[model samples]
Target: MTKEIEIEAKNIVTKDEFVHLCSSFQLKKQDFHVQHNHYFDTAHFDLKEKQSALRIREKQHKFVLTLKQPHEVGKLETHQSIDKQTMDHTLATGIIPNGDVANQLRELGVTTNTFTLLGTLTTSRAEIDYKGGTLVFDESSYLSIVDYELEYEGEEEEKVETTFGALLKEFNIPKRDTDNKIARFFKAKAEQS
Candidate 1:
């Protein structure tokens, strides 16, 4: 398992804004890659209740299982790589793989056996190195939801926040009250229920 400290600022944007950002950043169409995130949770949302998330992401036919937990600095993410066969099996059976991810959930009092497939979110994403950070633009679709997002990942917290704020101001984009994609997906899933 690999642990990562994720510190990022994000805001929703319009399709025009997404296009404009790509042009402004000189990002080509080839820069964008597609990925599908399959989310999982218990029937009662045991993981969401703890502000945690579990997802198996497929990109270029590779699968990675990620667990995100709330943390003071941002979110603590634990990632484990699994093969396509494993991903397919889990999707078909609702049986999570045996590993640190499962152990972590068990520690949180979640029923590992009861985890269910939530839904999938697909995103076309482009990453660019800019201003001491990695700027990411994404267009996502899932259920009846379609949205664009801008996020900046960096180490220097203050600088990244300042840069992100400036970018939003420059684009005349308002910072929408938003959580990560997984949270939004879960909320959308709940609403449709």
Candidate 2:
């Protein structure tokens, strides 16, 4: 089991802005990689109601199960690495293997018995070091949705926000309230239903 406070500031960026940032920041093609995120929730979206998200992310031949819950500065994330066999089983059966992540969800009133795969979002992402933090750019796709995002990850809460704000201002990117990828995916699913 792994625990951490994820402090990050992010904004929804336009395609042009994404291109501009990639060029201005000199982001290399080599740094870009693809990550597939499989999101899960109950029939009634119990976890989303609690402002939480559960996902199994596959990248670079590794799998990690993560549970993210709301926190003051950012989200608190609990991650557990699982083998491909367990991941395949969970994806096929909607039954999470018994473990800390399962127990954590149970404590939150979201049992694995009711969980199902809601959707999968794939992101072409790249990261660059900047201002004592990491800046991330993502082009994500799922269910007729294609969007770009800029995120700043930093150790300190206040500094992250400040630096991110400056970057936003410098680029003249308007501030728009952005939802987490899972939430956006869920909303799209709900709209189609």
C-alpha lDDT score of every prediction, in listed order: 0.89, 0.90
Shift of residue 84 alpha carbon in model 1, Å = 0.7
Off by over 4 Å in 2: none
Per-residue lDDT over 53-78 for candidate 2, one digit per residue giving the tens place of the 0 to 100 score: 99999999899999999888799898
Local accuracy of candidate 1 as per-residue lDDT tens digits, 1-193: 9889899999988999988988988999899999999999887888889999999999998899988998888888888999999999999988889987887788768856657898899999999888989999999999989999999999877888999999999988888877799988877887989
Screening candidate 1 with a backbone cut-off below 3 angstroms (N, C-alpha, C), the clashing residue pairs are: none
Candidate 1: list runs displaced more than 4 Å.
Answer: none
Q: TM-scores of the models, in the given order?
A: 0.95, 0.95
- Residue 165 C-alpha lDDT in model 1: 95
